[model samples]
Target: MFSEPEEPTATRMRRARATACAALKVEDAAQNPIWGYAGRTLSGLVHGSEEDGWLRVVSETAARAGGRLWEGPRTASFALPASVPRPALHRIHDWTEEGWSYRAELYAYAPASVVSPGPVLDTDLDLSEAWWAGLGTALDALAAVPTDRVSMREEYIRRAVAEFTGHAVGGIPWSTAHGDLHWANLTGPELLILDWEGWGRAPYGFDAALLHIYALRAPETANHVRKTLAHFLDDPAVRVAELTVCAQVLQAADRTPFYAALADPVRRYLKRMGRGAV
Candidate 1:
């Protein structure tokens, strides 16, 4: 171990982080660690510099082993374009400790900071044309690949789109997506995508629509997103993708007040498309 491994605690985030650090042969970064959303799965992440001078990100995720969530990141790490501008996975350590399956992943630290602390983009970003080009290229490349998993179930897509829009959809264009795409999972100044734990196939333009939904509160940013990913967002075939994401946000809003703000905007958007009777 490069550092003394802390005792594993099933409930505490730091314990998992420390254990992962030790297993990955890394120490804590200069700054504090970041935690993901509070959920049934307990997880935490921190970054540090490796002996090789490359920045290393160590994260511990608690979930059932042999499932999609358990395998997504490791699968994406090897499957994605390594030459692209994103963190490169170097090593991984997974084991069952304290009656829970814990996965620790070590990735080359992303080159730029995340655009937003939360899923919603609350502020404007002065992204360059080159940045937009890079993002388009990356997303395009990602969409071209095939995958075994799926981000959204075909049955769910059909139900949600029909229930939300009062219109049925056929031949929904399916493609690979980052799945949980939002400003929080993207970097500023550069376009390095993060958190690949949910990557899988979905409706074409799903990623862009998700990001755009998050940016609705920030009109300038929202418009900028539309302008940038217009190729995906503007196509008539992408209506199902847009409706699918909006329905998801509406459903989430119903469950928690945190997502409430996005619900009305999505409703209006659906209504404008001659749908949204529901």
Candidate 2:
């Protein structure tokens, strides 16, 4: 269908990206291609004579890997409300070459710059008052937009909450969420949430909760996020969102050294909440 040669993975990813750009008829403007977890996706910038956009390429070794879900972000621009602060999708190219499937999306340029391109935020961000206000507005507007897309399965949420929070949950207050609200997916000075592959309905306050969890290592900033999104704090749904995010991070910890720091903070958080995860 499309590309990994490592086992040739990195090389295959790059070649796949180049071929995608050529097929899409865009010029590569980035010095380097940004890679996703384990190099499953590769992304860079592309430009024509007068226009520029971010070009992202994704590969799957199997026909059913992520299936239809991976197309959410690629098509999100056409459906999400204008109030949502995100780039507009310009074009998409999908094809099968050499037994691999590749899908490339070119989106209107993202302005300002990314806050952090990693899952964890170690530095304290001195975000502006306007930026904080904008984040709140964006989250609120996003929540109001209705969608049938499922970010996390109902059964998965029940099981994860029970496993991590040590309690059974019912009647979750659902709202649209970016699903992945880590520092890596956010931009600042101005607020622009990126990478919306999993945007869909989730428990209330999910975005705020996930954002807080990622900032836990930077205590001051984490506190700032909670304070900024205070309306979302103290809700039962938010608490569930928090612990569930903790479970996700803990799972990531075992695989990547960078995420290992998040596990202790999660345990401390659980203890504070009077719950213990076995």
Candidate 3:
């Protein structure tokens, strides 16, 4: 039972109309179709603009970098670059009445080829261990890429480590990280990682730490994850230190609403580690 804010009806209609107009401009099939307003969070509301024969409109507040923050529209445009996930970008407009909006080029929403059991919030220590093991494999795959090839911000990485490690205790390991790796951002049975807005290179353990800390709110689950992660690495101490830094940076960012659910011990641990770097 989450208490989510309701988007106004007039605003919904405006968004729907905008999606419809954008669809027509793109020469997508179907003129009039049912529109639905999806979930709203601290970031912004998700609206399914129009679902006709061939296309659908999915729009929301554009998320920011450095952290998982949402800022209003920076600029308006009809076509977005290939870097954007969608096929075509219809129109980008700023509305004083309705924040920034963009209509993605229409695409069919396909059902997942395989669907796992719905997310189980309570701890399944065994399952968590397996998940962590899989996560490690993913991280290793990500890390194999040469650092120079990836578009990682050196300043950001420097600041992150400097903020977390007062003195250079030891050199930090480098790798590309998802930046924010959480369940909600992931979609489909294929688990194709979506929401690449916060993606960039970071220290090796950042993604693992973020995922572990988020999952470890439950003591049993946290311990299980830690154990799983331990099996993957050569140096447990360094992994712990990296995880500490990730927890602190994540806590400071205040990205997830579920932060409130984190346990006091974990919170205290993060605060202690964060103080060392900041």
Candidate 4:
């Protein structure tokens, strides 16, 4: 079978940075440097620009839920109010410079990420119960606010779960979620969620479910998440959320090593859920 060649990282980074600089009106800024690079997007601190901020440049075709979550691609983010503890957005711009199109979002820079970006985090957090306490705090804060954003409904979950296990789950609760909740998008030494492009209303326990799914690689961490979010996860709706996320990672196992590692545990989980033993 033939596969398309992946674009070289250096080439992608330079193009992304160039688009970011142009859109941010800081094309000549000399202090700019790459802070992080996920597959289709790159973020860095901007300098010599009229405004001080962190810039995130992403490919246009990338699946971004921010548009619906924040009310469109050109609009500023106001849905996440002060209590959420996320970076404040400064501006947003979308355009096709050269042949490829892009969307650039500038935000106030955050100090650091809790763990390096990837499927698994190996850092010894030496975290206290207070750190775990923040998860519940953040989720409660998010749930208190209502939004017109799109819902991450159970039908989607049912389809995804059915794709793998030939079973469907229904009637899950819905609420706003940090759609891409995972260690990579979180910063610590202090808790700050990064990468808002996917924030929107999702299944009620979706964020914690995704986080726990990722933590399955570390049983202790997974247990910690389960215990902390037990208030919500105890709801049957939330169990469906966990199963939905597991189905997703299991379905995407070929693309990343992280998902590959999740296979067995997810399979075990599905089996239990299927038997109504969860």
Q: Which candidate ranks first by TM-score, i.e. highest?
A: 2
Tens digits of per-residue lDDT for model 4, 48-79: 44555677766644344335533332321576
* Candidate with best lDDT: 2
List the lowest-lDDT window of 10 residues for candidate 1. Answer: 1-10
TM-score of 1: 0.85
Better of 2 and 4 by TM-score: 2
lDDT of the candidates, in the order given: 0.71, 0.79, 0.42, 0.67
Off-target runs (Cα >4 Å) in candidate 2 are: 1-7, 65-68, 276-278
Residue 29, model 2: Cα distance from true site in angstroms? 2.1
**In terms of TM-score, which candidate is stronger, 3 or 4?**
4
Per-model TM-score, in order, reads: 0.85, 0.91, 0.51, 0.81
- Candidate ranking (lDDT, best to worst): 2, 1, 4, 3
Worst 10 residues of 3 by lDDT: 70-79
Which portions of model 1 show Cα errors greater than 4 Å? 1-11, 39-63, 276-278
Which pairs in model 1 have colliding backbones? none
